[model samples]
Structures are given as C-alpha cells and as structure tokens.
Target chain A: MTLKKWIKTPKGYVAIAMFAFLIIAAIGYKDSHGIKNAFTAVFAGVIVDIILNIIKRRKWTLPEGAVITGLIIALILSTATSILVVGATAVFAILSKHFLVYKKKPIFNPAAFGLLFSFLFFKTGQSWWGAFGDLSVWTILFLLVGGYMVANRIHKFPQVFSFLGTTFVMLALMGYFNIGDAVDALRPPFINGTLFFAFFMLTDPPTSPAKDKDQVIFGFLTAAAGTLVYAAFGGLIYLFIGLCLGNLYTYLKKRSVSKSMVNRKGFISTHR
Target chain B: MVKMDKKWVILCSTAVAAAYTSGFYSTETQAVKMESAQHNQISLHTKVQQSGTTGNIANYALNQQNKKAKQKYKDGTFTGSGMNRRGDIQVAVTLRKDKIVDVQISNWGMHYSESDVVDLPGQVIQRQSANVGIVSGATYSTEAFTDAVQDAINQAQNS
Candidate 1:
C-alpha cells in the first residue's frame, strides 16, 4: 500500500497515535533526547525493514509495522540510553520480523521481542517514559484517549480488555498480598506500560488469536505470566516475556492441531 | 483431542520456575546485605568508642540512632557510591551539622535506577535520615540511594 493508503489502515492509526503520544511526553519531560531516540529507532527500523524486505521479496515495501515496533521499543527504553543502543534494538526488531517466521509470518510481536531481547542483551534502563507518567496524573488522559482510538480501530477489544482487566485486578491482589509491592506496578510507569501493551502490542494481528475464546485465554495467560515474572525477576521485562509466552502458546496450539490432522490422515506434513 | 496446548503449559511453568529462582536469589542477597550493614555498624560503634574519638559523627549518630533512632549527620558535602550487581548508585550530599541541606545524585546505575530518585532525595532531606525505606518497585534505585547516602555519611563521620 502507498504511504497515504497505509496510514488509513489499522496499523497506521496505531503508529501515528503512538508517535503523537511520544511527542507529547517528550515535550512534557522537556528532554529532546526522547524525541531523538524515538526518531533514531524509527529511522533505523524503517531502513532495516526496507532493506530486508527488498532482499526477500525483490520489491519495496513500507515498514509500517516495523515503524510502530521501533517507536514502542524506543519509548520503553530509558530516555538516557544512547542512540546506538536504540538503533541496534530497532535493527534487531526488524530482523526478528524478517527471519523469525513460522509460516510466512513472524510468531512473536516484533516490538515485544526486540525490547525483551535487547534488555536481556544490553541491561539498559526501561523507563517506559513514553507513557508520560513523570509529568502529572492528568497525563493519563493521553494514554486513554490515544489508546482507545487504536484499540477501537483494530477491533481487538476482546484481547485488550481481558489482558488489561486481569492485569489490573491481579496486580492489585499482588499489592494486597505485598508481593514485590506489585500493587505498585499499578502506578506510574507500570500502569502506563500495561495499558500501552494491552492497547497496542498485545493485539498484534499475526501472533495473537482472533477468536473471542482464544483471545480471552491468551490475555489471561499473558497477565498471569507477567505477574509471575514480575514477582520473581522484579524487572520491567516481564510484560514482554509474558506476551512472548502467550505467543508461544498460540503457535504451539496451531502446530499441535495441524500435527493431529496429519496423523489422522496418515500423511506426513499435511498442514505445510 | 488436544484440549489445551501442552507447549503453552510447559512455557508458562518454566517462566514461573525461573521467576521463583530469581526472586529467591534477590531476597537472599538483600538479607545478606542488611545483615552485613547492621553487623558493620555494630562493630564500628565499638571501635569508635574505644578510640575515644571526639567530634566523630559516627559516634554521635549512633547515640542518636539509639536515642531518637537516627539523625545528626555531619556538616559538609560528601559523595557515596552504592554498588549492586547491575551497577552502582552515586550520590552527592550536602549536610549542615545534624541536618541534610541538599542532595544531588550524580549517577544511578545509568538506567532505570532513577525510579528510586523520584522522591527519595526530598524524603531524605525531609526525614534527615538515610534509613528511610526504598521506593516500591524501585528496589535497585532505593538500595543504591540509601547505600550511597550512607557511604557519604561514613565519609562525613570520619572527616
């Protein structure tokens, strides 16, 4: 799709909304570094995506999804991280989308995987500054408003709703029980991080299930996994890890179903 | 019928196991550090008394730590660095006799460690105590902040 037509798609709106929220946050922090990091990630992500796409398909394709992934990765990084780290992360994210395919589609959210692996590799900060948590309580308005627009456009309400509702209530329970002060995760960066993940990344079209029932299970699994990881490792990487786990579940279920069909038909590799 | 994905169950369980292991390690290390800090403080108290030192902030602070339960840092600007596995938290503090006049953190793990700094300095100045609790969810930052502050306090006490 042309850039104009592409922006009208679901991914387009999400990307633009995320970028807008980021700018608003950068302005609020009065730190140009945030904007710079985001742009660096985007530039790097787009370039890598285009380069890889050309190599694979022998035609040029705009990196719409990669752009969104880049922006999310940048926003989640510590605003103080170097541009080189941000660019490296963006490149890795695009690479995952290009090479980590299960069946002509990547099985993980590129942004989520990029952030998770980048964090594991670099051990840098994940301030999640894009949520504008440092500014003021009223700033949640930006997340709510923009997130609503994206989630509504994509029609992934079931997944988003389940993940968010379960995450909040479960985190509150963790807080009530005083698990890692997990209830604290319901505040500031964590809350914003959860909401952003729910409304944006968790709804990744290719990796997530669309069926209402599966979506609910996937969402609950993601939250359960996230809480478990957070209570254990006590870092911000839990969200991405949880989502990846959920993606693994989906990919496995699909594979298992296909395998069963192959076995019944007495044929090898029937699904493929 | 594969009612549920077996791989899903496996991955989820594995994540839980890893989380538990990490949490256990973090808590154990924290306990050790607390014990060490307390142990060091007790031993240092005895040594300072035997030395019959006058105008030593550690002695006065210990007396206060027992009496008012904590305060009386020395006057001057001192820097302290708290080390953890991930990195260190370095803080520069200015004190006026028994009161903390100012605190500016120079480096905090170079990353998410600032979560601890959000309101910690203000709290340190307000309470005038480095024994203040850490910011929830900012454990690394909190430990580093108090550790570095205590380090600086040690410098102030000795000098």
Candidate 2:
C-alpha cells in the first residue's frame, strides 16, 4: 500500500496513535532511557521482522505491526530495564509472530506473548512506564483521545466495553469480598496502564473476535481471567496473560467451527 | 440460559485453576518481600540513626522520644498497610502520649526506584495526620503511603 493508502487503513491509524503515545510517554517521563528504549524496540522489531520475512522468502515489507509491537513493549516494560532485555524482547516478539503460528499466523498478540516470555526468562519488571503514570492527571486526556479513536475506527467498542466493564466489576467484587488486597490495584499506574491495554492490545484485529456478541464474550472472559490472575498471583503480567488466553480461546472457537473459517492472508498481513 | 461455547467453558475452567495457583504464589512472594523490606530499612537506618538497632526502628525512636518528654500518648508502636503500584506498603508509627514521635516505613513491595515515599513519612509526622501532605509526581505511591501512615496513626491514637 502507498503511504496514502496505508495512512487510511485501520492499522495505519492505530500505528499513528501508538507513535503519538510514544511521544507523549517520552515527554511525560522526561527521561532519556524511555526514548532510547522506544528506539531500541522499534529498531530491533523492524530488523527482526525484515530478516524473518527474507528467510521465509516473503517480499521485503515495512513492518508496521512489528514497530507497533516494539513500541508497546518499550512503553509497557520498565524504562529501567536493561537495554539488552528491551532489544531481546523486541526481537523475540517479532519472532513469536513468525514461529508461534496458527495457520501460519501468530496465535497471540505478538507484544503480549513476547512480554510474557521476557517476564518468565528475564524477570524484567513491567512498569507500564509508557502510560505517563507518575506525571500529570492531564496525561489521561491523551490516552482517552487516542483510545477512543482506535477503538472507534476498528469497530471494537464492544470488546473495549466488555473488558473494562468486566474487569472493573470484578475489581468491585474483590473490594466487596475483601479478596486478597486487590483493591489497591485500582489506583493510578495499574488502572491507567490496564485501560490502555484494553483499548489497544486487546483489540488486535486478527486475534480478537470480530462479531459484537463474540467480542462481548471475549472481553468479559479476558477481564475475568485477568482479574483472577491479578487477585490470585499478583504481578504485572496479568493483562498480557489474559489477552494471550483470550486469543487462544478465539482461535479454538474458530477452529472448532471449521478449518476454513480463518483467512490465510490475515496471517500474512504485512501492513497490520 | 444460552448455550456457551465448549472452548469457552474449558478456557474459563483453566483460568480458575490458574487464579487459584497464582493466589498462593502471590501470598508467598509478598511474605518474602515483606521480610526483605525489614532488612533494607535496617541497612538504611543504621548510619542514619547511629544506634545500630535494625529490627525495632520504630521502637527505638519511641524510646528516644520517651527520654525527652513525659509519656503523653500510649507508649507503643503501631503498623498499618496499603496498596502501592507494584504491591503493598506498610508504615509503623511510634507514639508517646498524643504525639507521633517517629515513623518507620516498614514494608513496600515495589522494586521500582521510587524516592517519593521518603518524603511521605516526614510529612505525616510533621502534619500529625495522613490527611496532609502529598509528594507531587508520585500520586499513587503517595496516596498509598498516606493511607498506611493514617492507618498507623489511627491505631496509635486509639491505643
């Protein structure tokens, strides 16, 4: 697609928004490491995506999805994380798309899967420092604007609705039941970063359910699983884990109906 | 009731199992972090206090206050906890009569290099209430710290 054509695509729009988030994060954090981490992730992700595509005999392509994935990982992971871990995660994330396949496409959200793997192997902290959490309350306005645009453009409002609704409702239940001190998570960084995830990551086109009904179910289940994860285990990886499981559920649901239901081209999507 | 997808059912079941297992793990990890936080404060305050008493920083502070003034409030240390971004934060307040003589930030589970909580204890001590003072730019940690200090103060006031 031409730059003009790509700019109009849903992924293109989201990519712009994601980059805007990076700029906002850089400004809000006012730290050189976050900016460097963002570049490292983007560079690593793009390089890996190119190398993998060439090795697989695919055409040379602009790896926008990989860039988005790298940016998300950089933004979400702790800015204090070693640059080596950041670069490794971006590479692993791109590799996950190539290796962890469902009908030759990645099964989980690449960033989520990559971050989860990094967490297990590296024990790297996920500060979600991209949310500008420690900065002004005004930061939320940017998230809200970007979130609304992307969610609206993709017609994934129901998924966002269901996920946030179910997660907060579950959180409310935890509060009522006094379930293992999860209420404190409703505060700034955790809550803000989680909302950003729901709006951006959980709505990935290939992995998430398309229909409104399925999306509602998908969102609720994701939230329920995440809440369970958060309340029980207590870590920063709950959102990523929830999305990974939700993706698995969607894949299984489609596979159960018919093998032909999924599009092969969707997996090979160079733009998205 | 609508018939749910079989795959969904299985996934939900798996989620429940995962949650159950993780809950246990979280509790254990939190306990370990709490134990270590006690150790960090010891290393931190040894030179700051010059007394070399690590385990009972709050108690030692209370004793120092006792030497200078007749006991005004209940003579004991109190502890309270609240949630932070990464984990829970706990504050121990030392009291003599009605005055908050000293405060020890007992446990904070965050591994993030946060300098904000350092100012929070002093604010609570000076203000005599968790109702006052918030370190700017550290909104969530400050809120949690204030809550923890308030919890300790309330215990001291009541006792």
TM-score of each: 0.67, 0.66
Q: All candidates: CA RMSD in angstroms?
A: 11.8, 11.9
Here, model 2's chain A TM-score works out at 0.92
Compared to the true structure, candidate 2 yields what TM-score?
0.66
The worst-scoring run of ten residues by lDDT in candidate 1 chain B lies at: B1-10
**Highest-scoring model, TM-score:** 1
Against the true structure, candidate 1 reaches a TM-score of 0.67
- Candidate 1 per-residue lDDT, tens place, B1-159, comes to 012344653454355435434433434544466447646654654564466634334456668767975454557898877754334577898877565788888875432535446688887777666766755335556776777776676667633
Question: Whole-model lDDT for model 1 versus the true structure?
Answer: 0.72
Tens digits of per-residue lDDT for model 1 on A1-272?
68798778988898888889788888888988888888999999998888787778746555778778888988878677788989989988889888888877888899888887777777555777787756687888888787767766665666766676666666555555556645346555566777778878898888898786888799989988987887765766788999999999998988898889878787645655
Candidate 1: regions farther than 4 A off: A1-4, A263-272, B1-159
Q: Ten-residue segment with the worst summed lDDT in candidate 2 chain A? A: A259-268
For candidate 2, what is the DockQ? 0.07
